[model samples]
Target: MNFDLFWLFRSLPAVILGLTIHELAHAYTAFKLGDMTAKNEGRLTLNPLKHIDPLGFILIVIAGFGWAKPVSFNPEHLKNKHRDEILISLAGPISNFALAFFLLLCARGLFVLPYFHYTATGIEIINLLVSWAVINFGLFFFNLIPIPPLDGSHIYTTFLQKTNPRLFQLVYTYGTWGLLLIILIQVNTKIQILPIMPLIKAITNYCITLLHFT
Candidate 1:
């Protein structure tokens, strides 16, 4: 077993930050959309402790993919169930993307400071920022996978419920198991079935280009 302690040290905070922001966005959006369940449950805050799931956090640290505690919302309280549900589901991923971009911008800003690049601390800060940005980007895309219990599933199922009720019911019922199976297979076989890294790298490269970072 080849354990990388340095990777763990760098990724732990990034994972916590990403998960915290992602779940908080969900809770906040639900609150804004007239659902008080998340807020009433004391989840509408930036505190990572409220959002972190122990096993999930551990998995993300070791496996590069995992989940946070989900925000609960009452769809009945929403003004428009379908639209508001989609919006609430979208909030998590959107927040992660926004955070990633902000992190990249922060990194870009750090590059121009006088003699900042000459110090070990500056380089470490920039590396941490970039790592955090990448983790947030991963969270953004990973949550958007259209499987049960993921954010994208709400959007997918909402539309599918109209066109094909039976199919939608089937997916809604068993999609989580399917997702788990896929994950298990990938873990054991080391196959890149999801192909999400390419997208993350593309986005990172695009941000780097736009920010003129070396």
Candidate 2:
């Protein structure tokens, strides 16, 4: 919430890493599924410059909902068109979850290391890593709300297609509203009612529990 230089400075690395991984997951998933759209556009690598969306990045830091420039994917190239497309789309959020968990475990290790003789730098790195975990996990969970333009929507879409095609279309078409509602609930209200906040709290608590009370 703090927009001071210190917060912005520390948050920059986390934003870059978060956004980079978010896009890379999609590109890599598509590439693995036989689509070269993302790779051809040079989005498969970890170089943050390639995926940065200037406006999105700025809004993301401010409003906490910015996305990276989307990686191109032609679902037609996938062997199982519908299934693989859903997988490719779902990959981004899944990767964020994985990264957040990895960072959490890493932070726990750093947190305990100081008691065993780690230096100040080690603790500082741990702080940064914890920030990364919190940010990544929040983003991951929030983005998977089954709204249009979000990975969860694609995942949910695949399932809906099998049940009721018309309903699926309606949901997908109205996804913008769903997304907007998520933003409003989580951002505007002083009392947080969104699912994401609780999940983040549980994850953070788990990290602390893992390290033990020293």
Candidate 3:
């Protein structure tokens, strides 16, 4: 497949911003939950480099779904360890969804403004906003798959711990391979196993439809 450098360039800013905010949300949530591990490790910042995993970021650029450096937190420091861990793990995706909504609103508002004609600048701004919204939404949903190393796995494991320790152990031990297998299928096939892009489009289209601007 041929790579589109211009498309990559246009999407880079949004990807970086989405990843940064996603990770910062994790770090901040962990800190607020009394686990200062991420904060102490200097992860409580908006710096893109601090959050960007090289391989993951490259995958995002090429494949549309990727991850970032996970924020580490000590469970001992949390009051309700399992529940709190779930909440902390959820913060990243929640932040991305929030950003997606905000960017959607911006795109809609820009389209509705009387002074905002479809000039080069206006078109660029709209494209940027839409790109950012799509990226954020992609991140939000992509991270919600219940697989190891992703935020959703923490929640799944937490709940499983109370219900079935054996099953939890089984999943915990083998989950990484499941995630790797999904990536492998995505990379090797055209079937598009993950529906992240369709979900992003649906949400974005809904937001734009709500605005009734186009």
Candidate 4:
């Protein structure tokens, strides 16, 4: 597998910022929902070092989809276990989406600046802003796949645990392995077990279009 050095250079900032914010959102939401585990573990910070998983970071930069170190929380401490779990799980993706929208607006704002296009620095900044927005959008959708260790799994598995205990046990036990297998297959071959690029591109384009009218 060949790595693109230029792509990595441009994507590093977005990857770090997006992953940090995503995990921090999880930690903060869990803390707010009465789980102090993440806070006690010193995860309620904006530091990228605390949130980034090395392999995930590399994969995201190269493959456009990956994850951060998951924020741990004690379910026993949560006020409403099931409902709060869903909210905590959702916080990461929601925060990424919000950040993406904000970044898009910032990028749009750059277009109106006088002399912005004439300067190399301004052009690079705008490009970075757009890249950041799209990367965040990718993070937003990627984390929502209902596989284990991802945010979406928690939401669905919470309900599954109640309605189908046996099935839930199977999923909870094997989902991570299944997710890893799918990733490995994609890495080795051309099959897209979880095709998400189209969704990411569609949403990013839609947001850009909306910004154009504003």
Best by lDDT: 1
Candidate 4, position 104, lDDT? 84
**Per-residue CA lDDT of candidate 2, range 1-214, in tens?**
4345777788778878888998999999999999999999999899999999898788677767677887888877989988898888878878887888788777776666646326777778877887888888877887787777777788777778779999988887787666667675666666565577788889777766766624
In candidate 3, list every pair of residues with a backbone clash. Answer: none
Ranking by lDDT: 1, 4, 3, 2
- lDDT of predicted model 1: 0.87
Query: Across residues 1-214, which tens digit of lDDT does each residue of candidate 3 receive?
Result: 3367988988888889899999999999999989889999899999888899999888777766577888889888999988899999999999999999899788887977776746888878887898888888888988988887788888778878779999988887688777777877876677677787788899888877877756
Clashing pairs in 2: none
Local distance difference test, per candidate?
A: 0.87, 0.79, 0.85, 0.86
TM-score quality measure for candidate 1: 0.91
Candidate 3 C-alpha error for residue 35, in Å: 1.2
The stretch of ten residues in a row with the least summed lDDT in candidate 3 is 111-120
Order of all candidates by TM-score, from best down to worst? 1, 3, 4, 2
User: How large an RMSD does model 2 have?
Assistant: 3.0
Off by over 4 Å in 4: 61-64, 118-120, 162-166
Q: Which model scores highest in TM-score?
A: 1
